[model samples]
Target: MDTYQTMDVAVVGGGPAGLSAAVTLARSLRSVAVVDAGEPRNAPAEGAHNVLGQDGIAPRDLLAAGRREAQEYGALFHDDRAVTARRHDGGFELVLAGGTVVHARRLLLATGLVDELPDVPGVRELWGSSVLHCAYCHGWEVRGRRIGVLGTSPMSVHQAMMFRQLSEHVTLFVHTMPDPDDDAWERLAGLGVEVVDGLVRMLRTDRGVLRTVVLADGHEFPVDAVTVTPRFVARSDLFEQLGGTLTAYPMGAFVATGPMGRTDLPGVWAAGNTSDLAAMVAAAEGAGVAAATAVNADLVAEDADTAMRARAERYAVA
Candidate 1:
């Protein structure tokens, strides 16, 4: 705990959420530190979209810009992960992946989620390049190109429909699904999508350009781009380790936060993807600002409470 002395606030993760939170807190004159593992989920994406003022920006570039903004505003950036968080006396103790310990009066967990992609051939190679997940991010670029959406969730058909809006050609490959509902079938029919019954054996390619899909039934569906709707697992185990409860969902999950991002933890708060999975870049920036404000307010209250108690004690002594 004494390794870094004391901090006003400590933010975990380095993606949109943590970066935004650190920037907001630092701008507010708080001595803030951001602990990042540098493993962003969208690292493989070519660029991100639907974010105000930063639409179509590359994920890594955006993160770098965020780091600069936060650092310039007095946020200390560290290339480490907060592997554990435990409650301390009126503060928090954070242990990084490298065994570095930092103590802070308040904590902000902006650790984002991780997506588990399927082990299809050439999938990882094309990730963040030609193979994308979010339609709002990459659909426009791949429009009219042959697109394939692998079934990974109940919302997968819905994602395919979104892609269909961007392209005339879409195929919803029925892979790794126990059974798709009638509504899914209906959506596919309405969107005029090709449905492949056989499992996806592998993806054929041409020097990083996805060419075709080899199926189980000795068939192939050639595609120029592939969209996947992966299941997101919230990387909030550090918070969970401290008995922090969360509301989990299929596509995403979030720690329950109040108006200003205060969770049930006394000296701990949350912002960004850790608490609001739907938050984009600009929105997360605003969220980080709000959460910092909330944390500051809590500190103010504690200060006031201490002062009032001391004044009362002095009068009692008199």
Candidate 2:
């Protein structure tokens, strides 16, 4: 490990959000460091969407580009996970998995969420490729094909509707979801969506391509693509012990934060999926920018306050 060092801000996570924040802070002449575990949430997807000027770009490419850009602006990066963090000396101290420790005046938590998939077999094997979570992210590529929306909860209703817009043939599999009321049925009927009520036994794939969905009752429905609603669990254990609180949402649990990623804990901020479970790549990057701006402003205010206090002390001595 390197000698003890202090930085202006320490960013945990290296996805679009964290990298964006690091670039912003570094370009602003602030000493920023990003510690990434290298396990991105979208690593399995072929490419990312809704990102301007780089639509259809692979997630790895985008992250590499972001790292290069941030590094050019003098941002430091650590390729290890942050195991623990604690408040120290009016700032924060983070210990990495490799026993490296970092001190920073401010902290930005960009750690994203973990997607807990359904317990059905082959779903995990096909995730991010044939089995998707976001319609907007993978809709166009899989559009105009037979699509299946696996029901995990009532939220699956929205997934079905979104996919229905892309594909003419759509099926909502009530794998474990309760039966919807007449209004919900009417909506599904209006959208020309067929409802299949049965527990999914497994996803059937051939040569890594999704082919069909197998049911427990020996029925099989052919599908070109499939979508599922995953449980989003935040990666916030490192900071949660440091007075940060995780809030519950219908989708999952996330760190509670105010404007510009300000959390209830002082000297600590959170952004990206750590705070917003539903934020896409582009939205997460925008959040990173916003958080960086706010952190810079906070630092400026603190610097001014310290300078004024020193001046007052010197005047009193004179």
Candidate 3:
């Protein structure tokens, strides 16, 4: 039942986006707090790519560095999950799993999305390792190697094309995805990509390392890495609790926001995967900064109005 002082801003989910926002708000001398559940979306990935000045850094290490930087700027962090949220007294209140309550004038949800991998066997076990998505994230490591794209959705064809740019040895396993159109088949053939038509039974692994893709028809193809198109579902429980509806997309669902991370919910904002499903680590960080600036500006306007009202009252009293 411990309650914290009402902060200027409360950021939920302490990943790249939340931490960046915390740093920015703290630098602006705004009282800010970050609540994290400690389960980062990229925790399974060995390294994050495309992050400038710290490319290929491990996900945990990057987050640790972000936490340190935010702390250095006087941002308070709670390593607990925000279990419940409700609007309160012209602001918002969040109840943590540990029983602490956080009160803030503004709420920012940087809770990243969850990657729901294909139901195929071995995919979850090897995720973030031999099983991967996003050509920009782990494509370089598998470059010039035997890369297999698991067909789970129409986007699987697009994935094959993306990986073809990185590796000459690319195979598209048409497991469950719809048959490619004539133009898609022609493009794949033009790129010399092998197309295998069969239901993928499982991904064969040896000593926890992926070795091959096994088909239901008893055929197996050796591969160095497999790509999948996971459905990206954003973490939006708290947002929903606050009466925010998730915007559905063909690939997944997310909380919709404006360019500056301002959500439709009043006094509530979102950044990172919560709003932008395609955002990478660097892009999430940028979104967080943008949301922080917007929140700070909103607060500045509110403060000015309050001051003006106070001055008017003072003159009347005099």
Candidate 4:
């Protein structure tokens, strides 16, 4: 590996967005480096669905391929976690966990989201397989399967309604939540969803395939799918340290960004789930492409101004 004095782009996180940005910048003839912590929140996920042509690829396999593709394009992959980021003279300086320093002209935060699932047993096992999160992502594959929409709040009422579009045999499990409003109740009944008011004990499954949900009342309900809106915590603490304000989301807080992932702070950009709470892997990659292009343009403008000033200085010296 060539010892890089400075990188044109420094992408944090090795997930889809970071890899996509690094690859694009490298192809554009820029030195790029990706800092990844080697842990994805979706590690337990059996496969990444909803990715066109690459559906059903395991999470690790998908990331491995991304890393390989980016590396092939001369993008350096740093297997260390970036702990601190401060604005430098030209761009930003990052301090990794082990005191490694990397200087970059631009930054991309692609650190993905972490889903805080329910405290119920077997959730980790069933998650990303029979137990799912996004309806648009995993709904089609689980169509016609008996599904349960576990309620963490009144929002589960809407989730149950959405899943009804996929299957008529959907059940809404109201785990420890109070009764829904009249309108919420009406929506469920109108959708023909079965509402259960018992705490979920365990989501019994087999080998990544789901079987049924066992409730605390000792009632085992046969369910082929379990949909719960797992809580989320943003993966981008680096952005927060840079004074980027986060907006509150129903699931979690995420870095606020412009259309192309440019944050309020200059020289620092964010894409993927770190900023886009609802973006899929494909969408995250697209966002990264857009952000990288914008960052490159910004840097080019900066370099042009610097060159013009130097020209004036030379003319005066003459």
Candidate 5:
């Protein structure tokens, strides 16, 4: 590995959160570096919605623009995965997949979460197109169409209810999820969502357009769009080197963090999907800005203390 170069902050992941943090830190005159492996969770999606002022912007375009903005401010970006990290000389050093090492005084773990999709056919192929997860993200576009909510877990009930608001014809396919309780049944009935029994054999599509959902019993329900609840898992394995931990929720697990994305470990912070699994692109960007602000304040305090100590040593020498 080459000799480690020092930086003020290392932002990992290169998604909306990472780019946002790099831009903010670089604008503040801090030496910032971003490490990303180019695998974004939303890469399959044609466009990212629900991000104000950037609604419907292609995910790649958004990241490219953010990268250019940060580069204009002298922020360095490494197109490699940070495979390992450890505490070093009162800071942290990260080893990338490309055998380069980087040391930084503070770290921003913005590596977002991964969505584990259901083990069903055609779901992966049509994902981010006709098959979706979030109603707020792609509901409006498919409104008034035949929408199907595949049952992967109990959470599918909520997904059906949310999508029902956007479409009149909504079906809840109990493919593999446990049977709904009385309350869930009541809610589904109230929302006018039809419940289908039996495991889903596969999704039927024609010419790249979703057509219907086929059950194991050969029952077919016509559908124009579908939604599934995928398990959300944050990319926090590298946090082990810093003695950081994650917290588990009903939906998934994420790194634990306090206000301003401060983690339990000193000199380390987390933001975006690393901590908030429910955060969208816009929310993740806001969290990155907040964390950057806090990090900058901390560096300012450390700088003042160093300056004072240097003055004291000079006076003693005189």
Candidate 6:
């Protein structure tokens, strides 16, 4: 099996967070390795929004640029998935699916998350295009269009209000979400949002283009775009292997971390969507940089301690 030399840091998932962390660590003169399976959560999206100076850039293109930047900084890239993890020699060892092993003194998880979209037909097929979530992510592109919000949870009402800000033709299909309270009804009315109460059978499409939302009762609502609230489940398989538990919330679950992305596990940290489910691209990049700085500081402290110990031993021998 191929094995890499012990590195200062090993980052899993080469998305925005992982690549950003690798760049920061390499710039600090640390030997960093990034392992990626090449499966990005946002790959299906047409463009990444709200990215400063690079707005609306294709997701794959953004990642390619990031990879080049990290490589230029002397960070190593492993185009493989980490399948297993364990403690080794007071550090961490990760076994990749490609039969490669990596050892690092510190581990940073930027594994992002998985969006479990609603089970309704066409929802998954149209995800990142006609079907959407996160108003800030794609709301602008869909402004002034026929927007429909699929109610899967209580948060659906809130989703409607957010889209209403961008367009006047907003409709909330209370498919499977809980019944809205009186206040919610009043709020919807005040905002001129239409509420449809029925089970959504499917999202009808033409040549992969979303056309309408079909209800179980045979009623169809024409919509240019449909929004949903997906359960954001963090990609924490390696974290779990390292004996870390995920923190659950109403929206989904994620890895719990303290300041600078420090997790409960020693010598291990989490950044980006792994720790913050709602983190956008810019926020994920920031988290990665923060975690890298913290990891570098930790290594510095350890090196200083080792140097002091060696000095004491030499003096005693003299």
Q: How many clashing pairs does model 6 include?
A: 0
Q: Each model's C-alpha lDDT?
A: 0.81, 0.92, 0.96, 0.84, 0.91, 0.96
TM-score of 1: 0.91
Model 4 — TM-score against the truth?
0.92
Query: Model 4 Cα RMSD, Å?
Result: 2.4
lDDT digits (tens) for residues 173-201 of candidate 1: 88875577888788789879988887888
Off by over 4 Å in 5: none
Q: Estimate each model's TM-score.
A: 0.91, 0.98, 0.99, 0.92, 0.97, 0.99
Tens digits of per-residue lDDT for model 6, 1-318: 998899999999999999999999999999999999998888889999999999999999999999999999999999999999999998999999989999999999999999999999999999999899989989999999999999999899999999999999999999999988999999999999999989999999999899999999999999999999999999999999999999999999999999799999999999999999999999999999999999999999999999999999999999
Q: Per-residue lDDT for 171-277 in model 3, tens only?
A: 99999998889999999999999999989999999999899999999899999999999999999999999998999998999999999999999999999999999
Model 3: lDDT to the true structure: 0.96
Q: Per model, how many backbone clashes are there?
A: 3, 0, 0, 0, 0, 0
Residues 70-163 of candidate 2 have per-residue lDDT tens digits of 9999999999999989988889899998999999999999999999999999889999999998988999998999999999988898889999
How far is 244's C-alpha from truth in model 2 (Å)?
A: 2.0
- Candidate 2 lands at a TM-score of 0.98
Q: What pairs collide in candidate 1?
A: 44-128, 45-128, 46-128
Per-residue lDDT of model 4, residues 92-170, tens digit only = 8888987788889888898988888888887776777777877887888888879898888656887888889999899
How accurate locally is residue 186 in candidate 1, as Cα lDDT from 0 to 100?
Answer: 86
Residue 93 accuracy (lDDT) in model 5: 93
Candidate 1 vs candidate 5: the lDDT winner is 5
lDDT of 5 by residue, 12-44 (tens): 889998899899999999999899999887899
Residues forming the 10-long window of minimal summed lDDT in candidate 2: 237-246
Better of 2 and 6 by lDDT: 6
TM-score of 6: 0.99
What lDDT score is found at residue 115 in candidate 5? 91
